[model samples]
Target: MDIVWFPLHITLFICSVTAAASEAALAKPNCSSHCGVLTEIPYPFGIGAGCYLDHWFQIICDRTASPPKAFLNVIGLEVLEISVEGTLKVTSPITFSNCSNKPLGLQAPNLEGSPFVFSQKNRFSSISCGGIALMTSLYGSTIGGCLSICDNTNTRVLQPNSCSGMKCCQTTIPLHLSAFNTSFGAVLNADSQMACKFAFLVDHDWFTSNSTNISAISEMDSVPIVLEWSLLDYTNFEIYGTNNWTDDKITNCSSHCFCSKGFQGNPYLLDGCQVPSSVLGQLFLLFGGWWSHKVVRKRKHIKRKKKFLKQNGGLLLEQQLSSGAVNVDKIRLFNSKELEKATDGFNADRILGKGGQGTVYKGMLTDGRIVAVKKSKIVDRGEVGQFINEIVILSQISQGNVVKLLGCCLETEVPLLVYEFILNGTLSEYIHHQNEELPLTWEMRLRIAIQVAGALSYLHSAASSPIFHRDIKSSNILLDEKYTAKVADFGTSRSMSIDRTHVTTKVQRTFGYLDPD
Candidate 1:
């Protein structure tokens, strides 16, 4: 009799567990979980007043529309998506310029005293021929902005899916950003009949995935932006009139809240997060193995980066900069991933030029700044010290005619150097391959020569250390949009102490331009 009873009791317990798991709640009892069109409005967000966790989570379902669209009542923005992952997607209006026929005011949403903040996944974007867009906080503080410029041509041909400061430009927003105002400066060539200029904050991923053509974007009234949501007090179960969840049931409870291991769904709702009885043990093992693998990979990646940093003379450069009077902040150490993304995985199309030392690629940084990245060929380990010294010397030299070294990336097998992007090509290109439309005039040539001589003089005598440009030719000189000369390519240059008159070194010069000395 005892054996039979034990078997029956075990069966009953299993049945009960399965029944409880199937009853996992998505929203408050007797509350609508979703509105028309949007079917996945998870808990923490509800359609009725008492259904939601708080006022901030209230969703007002407007039945006047054809499909009865849902809107976030607190912010009054149309809700596109609400995920348990603590993100809310909504449609935001675009701010048009005064010259545009559309409305001429800013769309500044006030999210103060709420749990929502603009996520970093959104980008501040602007569209104009030559205009500057600015984003400011509620307190009238400048947040960030970008400038978009284009040529004065009737047929403005913009590249499809590219926003590298042409007719369209994009920049990143600060973290924990809640509210902001968008305004535009004076447009360069404002035309009422032309496409109207506008600015807005949009989801970066969505914008990149969609057709970024001016016509397509101009047709749209609004764009989707993501907002990160978090609960200030998760332990306040009294506010919800429930005491079902304990501290052990939730994890990552600092700013954002998540279910513990083996649990799923909204952590803010009672019984909203649960695991099936049959797959409970399997999920535990799976999560454990995944977490372990992630940890191992992260550690390995960090170790590899540290090894590369030391090997590429990063440590030596730090020591030299600390010992000298040069400002260490002038030169930045960039990670390899950043440059890779900026250059679209270093695509072949981005190649600006190639030389014996390395190849130069045109890339746009996250801040909308155009830059030139130089990926060098493999170097001997013996020359690591010299490379570090050159970087130190370059950081100290500040001349208008010299190409500015913005930063370097030592994490790659071949080190990369970043410099300010020059709009025009090298002097050699202009001299060799002339353009009929924009020919190099004699006056421009004379001005370039004078600028080059001034740059060389600065390098030789004006700098803190006497430097010699072993290779100085037309190909080594770059021109800006205004035809100003910018001396470049310091790979073959050397620096000497102030006390020394001259130092002998191996001659490194281009053929047909060698000095007779």
Candidate 2:
């Protein structure tokens, strides 16, 4: 009887220890893993002090609201779901319309100082008898549109999960797009009998749930919009030992990491992410370690691309192209993969030159066209507006002496500009490089100078808008294979109205090229 009692007590002790461990693993020390109905407010996002990574990720749990509502700090958007895959779903109020065409438009949500960005998965959509809506970014770039047309005679047939531009229409926004201005097109008095016009950004998934009836969406006060968030500064290689997550450790850190590849859980926990026993065997045995690592790397690469897209104003660029502001036929938007492959993964051997702004790489596109890719060194928030403006200004340039901006890649941390590769290199290289076997002849130098001068003249007066090439130096002038001079490097360039005689701006130029004034 004594031996049996001893075994029973040992079993009870082991079971108690395991239970405690499980509870501790679920959440960080002194931090609640849940808030009211939201039972899974993971690390990096928390409802209480010491639980969240920072003030930007704080969730305000409003208990007064019936059933309790979770709101992201300052933004005040109602949180519907939080995904560890760097995405969240939130609800936005919509204007309701009964019979009269109620002006239905909501100001875009401002997402400054937060890691959150509007996902491409959310579309600018509308439901109305006949209404045209426009979606523009904070900088006044039109991103997308939703136009719904209807007739008073015909009975409307609504299709679920589809916006075919009849009674309902939808258009896509860019990955990092956040704020937007949505306004309905003015209707003629004849169409005053139209029912209502409703337009707002919405999650793609929500369309399938209740998309059968267009009226159902209009009747509802709010619609769901999907947003993406991430730890942009964190790397995939960072890892920690088992079960060591404490409130004090990651309270201020903005990033968290999973235990290993294929593991799915809160990355902030020591043992949070783990392969389940059920599928772990099959995954490891069939795919092996290399395949698992590859998959994990791919996911990390995708997240990085999304981060770059947001930082570089990808949405605005897309909007410009889609809205016909920029001609896509003449200018292309390259993704990270394309540019990487083009430049041999940006190897040192492929480097063309380096400047204070960034590096240029010699690349070959899939079409066998050799190009120069200018990758910026940094992305200043204040400079983003100017960067977009430059793209617009360059796209309009068709002068023969100006280096053609073939396209750009906004899907990077800093925007990259692609130009027609000048094989002979810059004018400075030919004139200053000691290794140059053939020096420029007097005639060639005079011709090059004339070409550059003509290019500047075209930019200043002949163009639709006046452009000021503030930094006009020998280094900024390139030479094609034919040794014809082509004006390049518009990084410091500015544009003004055709009538403006001069514009006031901070002086920015290379050494030995500054205006004395």
Candidate 3:
């Protein structure tokens, strides 16, 4: 007993305790590991509110550009493509030699002012016809280039979008291109029989025969160009640590998607889209594949949604004749088209109110019943689909406080629940906006609260199956001109078996009045 345990064992036990404590104190990563699938609202590319840092990270959508360019704010750098691992394939514009009346030879364009620097790993990719393409840089630094090609008069040729020596001579400039003027010159060789000359930087893969074959002077002019850009002399680790973060990390992009800089891929073996370097690809991009992946996913998503609808009691609903004491036939089945007519395609003016569950619209039925319709935009959400529960709950109790369920329409893309229209505003409007607490009096607030509590107490205790009004916020409690309270918006309520007082479900009740448990 006096000797105690071994010294090494005691030391190990203490170390284990310290490690556990450290882990308990560790802070969670501030950012979300991945944005929702199909939703590309990445951290830097967020919606209205406080989603982004500032203007520097603006994702300017240029519909004017071919294929519509997406620029990253005031930096002036054009984003060619973004990857999941937080890397972007960008084009570094190089100043090619400017063609002029002067007799001077070729020189590198003025690339010194360019924010982007050329790297040995990148290429210049140029298309030419009849004339020489050259780039002249500052400080007397120069790089020269010459090109030649055949006429497109050959009958065996496919004159579509091609530029192979027959009419267009395609080539690449040396690495690390920056700042130079653009210019075109004649080679003055046997190929010099051509009248006009044309040249421009183009994506090696994007260059085509059309640039050369379709020209009036029979020379290539403006070719689609792509400049590969990366940080200079960065090790694998340093390249990944690019501090100039513009937008947030993109977890998901178009299919076969990878992350640009500032992100890494999923740590696991290629599960979701990520921005990892080693576990993910370094330089493997197929533009065609990336483009087509979206179409494939869109089709798949539509299928999944249909499947979810059928799974969530959609088929059971079609079975008809729910004999749970409630008059189930009172509820009508509405198609997406039917609801569009009823609410005028969910017109803004018809909107009564909006909540976490969905949008509420005012619609006039064919029989002239002006009803309030709650539409479930989130088809997968279980909250708005509890039509059966409401029908069951309403059938048992005949009460003045609870709003009557006029019925529901479920055959639509979104389930539309119809309730008796309460002409007066909500209790919140009286309490907050109109300062009803002052005008309506303290006795009115107490009476309204008591009225709401009584309605909920009845639902929770008296119904055949004990019902819990999961959402009980003041807004859900409506008030008539007579000051009588009528409980409304029981979107997330539960009707449990009398034997079992509570039921388990995916929690989607609104905040401020959510279940304590």
Candidate 4:
């Protein structure tokens, strides 16, 4: 009875071993895990039918080569390595030419339907004496290019692993690029066979790690190119569950799905999502602390801006602009950066003049427009309303005799006023400086009187809001390059409503030239 039982047990053991081997051959579900030497094909990528997630991840194992080779389906790009971060390493073909006038160009693979895309890790290179290489995106937009100009004397000392148009030239590609087209233009004076032009996209590591001569690029057929593989299509995980997925999940899925905060894993797979409990606590602490710090900084920035706005009379200006008192477009509110850049970081050399109201700096705008930036020495809390009144009055003045108020910068502790720069010295300098080489002529003096009178007349009567230049003086009158007088400095001016006869205000005027009326 014991011998009979032993024979039955042996048969059962053989059956179990065969079952385990069969199960190992079938990777997940019905997918083949290994294709010859390549055994690391994880989920989403499979060898045969029913094995892979879809046709996009299907791989073909070619056993006909000396050593078995595996290629991505349809595209025939040789597979080198697949990473957990969705990066695929594959062999890219090279295009080469030896003729001097005839330069060869290499085009990237047409990755139309596949889950794979060209990664930014790769750089497009052109090996030649001198030529213009153009890289274009799939949508027919020229992304970037590199030009190489070479000669016999400049041949031997090409920078090792550097592509800066010496012997070899290279440029970076955009991320998540599915397809690109590379073409080469003839190098101006490439006259040697060694100056053979070749172009290809290669992995950065291969270019740096290997001792590759630029002239010997034709000797190489295929270079390692990196690709990024994903789900290719995105399906709403909220609407489609793994157990009840529609055909769209298998076909038209999107590549936008990502692991939520505090969760990590292959977002392309179901149940592939995992939580590393050991590091999770630390990760949460780090991320949460960073988020909270950002929020605090943002709150501080808001509070500071609010304080400055109130101090700079931003509220009063807003109220005036909102009530249709001024044309909003005529008044430009400049930021601190523009003013800082225009004035060469507020260098002392740019100072045009200084006054009690503010200091004026000569600044060149980005558009080549010159302006005089008036920055107040101090922010008087009580005078905030008065500052806004000046801005409002200047925005309404359109007379050619008056200095045009171009814009203002309120982001600083004190508001800055921008005016069209007057090139010549002020009326006071031309009048008082007796030894000055360029004296104001009798006709010029008469023209200056007429221009100042016209500006004053417009301010007093023609303006939408009547203004009185209470502080008019020769010092306040600016002269342009042509010696045309431009009445300026409205800081101490007063405005009155249309129906009002006069504004009741303190008599603020420059001594010796006070308003006699």
Candidate 5:
């Protein structure tokens, strides 16, 4: 009898193990935010006091309102909805990017160099066939971009709509797009059909079925996006693979960098710290730029980009093709559906951050593609179009300082973009966070600032086609495992001929990081 139960016991054991993992995925960590009403804030995000990663991640939680209200601190975009799947339906910065009879309307501000980014895993899609969309995101290394198309045809009348270059299109972004810019326009092409343009980084599941929010647009006014914000772990300063000599089991965090006590300097450094220095009253410091460097090519397949541009009708594109100085194959495109599964239906459980435009979540695809997901407000009509533009542009440019585009999705009502994930969160979180001050030391901050400058110069002056970062703040600049900086988020970015200095616009950045002008 005992032997007979062996098989059953083994089966039960496997089942129990599976159940545990699932529970962890479903279990929402205690750290959370409480909105006034109708909002639920979960882990990696918090409310006042111990509720968040410091004030920057705090939720307003104004319960006095009838329906309740929550908001991000940086950009006062009102919060409408919050979910455990790491997504929220929020109002757009300029909810309607249409050129209707109204005055020049409000537009989602450009969010670059901020600690936030459009979750490359999230979709910037539209609701119906009568609208066009534009969007932006953080792709590989913080270079911003856009995706747009003069969509108006109802491609989903008889079947599910796909962004297969039809009435729809999509684009990817630099990995750490902390913020984005938004705009909506009528169909610019004669063959294309469109009435209104809608944009936002949406939950593919909700967007595909016209999500409840879209269905109830006539009733409610706005929705909120849960931005999954991140910051670089202090570990990057640990001095891995260094030339310094040492062979001792030691920890340098001093228990301050989220480690146990009996520690010393910043855990991010090699010998973190041990009683100042034996040099008595003097301390030593190194002056090299980077511990190591990897030089990547800065050119794309000029022919392919020209083909895509001509197919897409980018005037600046033809010129690039003529130059025959870049390679496009290096750019990648990803599927929207895959990103959906990766983000667990854009559940609130995976959220790592939130900010001016939307919320961001951490995602792990089936093939182990880890990513940060940015969700924009439902009102940004240009969300989808901007996504497509970003993919097209990133694929055509090659620069060491620039982030690379991976791929994008547009099969559902909303569109989803994909890109390599940057592990760190944003500069805001690191610099101002009350958690621990050990990470942003003299060396680390300088390294970060320098890396950012390199990327900015590349985008402004070096990119084959002159590009504008538009928003060059700290949040959009993401950090990697080695603490190296990677520029991010180009949702509001624009491309122009080398001869042009600035594009026509009045899109502003967040309060603190705005341009001096």
Candidate 6:
């Protein structure tokens, strides 16, 4: 009886092994699993026409190449590695400076409207003795960059794995980056006669670990960049609907799909993820469910924040600040939560003043510093540009007579500007509605007038660019604690080059404050 039962048990075990092998297929049935040297062309990313999940995932196998190379069909990027963990490593081209025989201008691959985005794990790097590289978004906004300058000794030696703005420089790329362009400033020293400058986004880990000799980077034409891929809609893939294999439990599916606890393989294929055979493995899955759920929630929250940041021009602001284009040292990019908490959800009681541009609210920051927050009323595309322009202008102005632009918050629907909270009211309040506590004497009035004139002189002549304050008025001027006048509200200000005499524009001024000239 024992011998008979042993044969029956062996038969059952053989059947189970066969079933597992059939279920754990890496690709669709009858489809090519490997292309040339790439042995791991899993499902959703296949070689043949009907094999791939979509056009974006189609891999074109170039058999004519020396070793047979696989390329991502749509983007034409050379495929280096594909991981089921939602990452694809590809060889991306370098943007060479115009000084080189290589094609001029940035040649960054366009990934817009595709399922792939440049992963944050990549860094924007520049290889040159004396060059300033800039990474700009598809919308023409500067996003990331680095300035590499040679030492005074004019030596070609660069420290291994060091990119600290000398000989070689590196900076971080923003989140949700799909497409970008690279540009370089004029050569720092033409007599240096160094090799041509080039910039590219490269996988940070690979670059640091492998590229020990940083000086040799100029000889390379392309670098490995990691791209994160995701299915915009997971419903396009096959769903698991079996015991202990529900869509949400066995296959964690969101914008992207992944095998659940105790499973390992492609979640995009039917029963692609292999199930646990041992009871201990199954028990591990049960305990891991809570942690997995927590991780998913955290990831979703982070993704949402990234989306908001990109939409609110945070990347552009970051680039400007990092590139040293904005000379001010105190300009900060405040987050939405910080500004919201400071203003108590923008309570009406904290209203400082209301204007055609926006409303101002008085608040105290976490650092116990008093600040006046300016929240724009409406935020159309035009308004957003104007808001950014105002930030740029204020950031460049360092005049003592001008209201100091402490920082700005762009994460909100409308951008918010923070300034040093003026203890006293506007000049209009003092002139029209006299303050009983602090009366404006004739001597004080003369001093305020002189300060205002000096601020105007600075704006028109001393400032980096000549600025025209189209809507200057008594209400736009603020008095500090010591009665020092500050020229504020540069929302309608326009900057022009010194060569230009005047700029034509539609009239933008307060009703009674129009220039008589």
- Tell me how far the alpha carbon of residue 97 in candidate 6 is from the true structure, in angstroms, after superposition: 1.6
Query: For model 3, how does the per-residue alpha-carbon lDDT over 1-517 read when each residue is reduced to its tens digit?
Result: 3125344544665564443322211111232212222113233332233433345334455667656655555555555543323333444433323334322333222335332444333233333444555554554455755455544453534245555555455545666565555555555454553444444444544434444433432232233334322223333232223454233443233222244465443211122223334211311222234436766886887776576556445654544345445556455554455556778878999998888768889887777777788876665545434654555566566578998777666555566777878888688877677763458688888888788778877877766656677777788888766879998776567667667744566655676676443
Off by over 4 Å in 1: 1-24, 99-101, 153-156, 188-195, 211-214, 233-235, 238-247, 276-517
Per-residue lDDT for 49-97 in model 5, tens only?
6444445445676568776777666666666654333344445542443
Q: On residues 1-517, what C-alpha lDDT tens digit does candidate 6 reach at each position? A: 5445655655665664544443335666677766666767777888887788778999999999989999999999899888777899999888886445566654768898998999999999988877888888768888878888878787657777777788789999889888998888766778654567789899999878854667666677788899999876444423332334445434546667777887766776776777646644544553376457767987987787687556656677677678675755678878888999999999999999999879999999999999999998865654566666677788888888899899888766778999998888789898998778878889989999999888888888898878777777899999998889998998877778888876777777676553332
Alpha-carbon deviation at 238 in model 1, angstroms: 4.9
Candidate closer to the true structure by TM-score (higher is better), 3 or 5: 3
The TM-score values for the models, in the order shown, are 0.47, 0.44, 0.37, 0.43, 0.35, 0.46
Runs in model 5 lying further than 4 Å from the true structure: 1-328, 378-383, 434-437, 502-504, 511-517
TM-score of model 3 vs. true structure: 0.37
How well is each residue in 218-286 modelled by candidate 4, as lDDT tens digits?
Answer: 577778899987653644443234446433222223553444555544444554434434444544554
User: Ten residues in a row with the worst lDDT in model 6?
Assistant: 236-245
| Candidate 5 to truth, TM | 0.35
lDDT of each: 0.79, 0.72, 0.53, 0.74, 0.50, 0.78
What's the number of clashes in each of the models?
0, 0, 54, 6, 112, 0
**Candidate 3 deviant stretches above 4 angstroms:** 1-312, 318-325, 334-338, 381-388, 395-397, 435-438, 501-517
| lDDT for predicted candidate 3 compared with the true structure | 0.53
Residue pairs in collision within model 4: 31-51, 130-187, 233-253, 233-254, 234-253, 234-254
Deviation from truth (RMSD, Å), model 5: 42.4
Query: Model 2, range 461-493, lDDT digits (tens) per residue?
Result: 887777777787888898887889998878777
Better by TM-score, candidate 6 or 4: 6
Deviation from native of the Cα of residue 444 in model 5, angstroms: 1.7
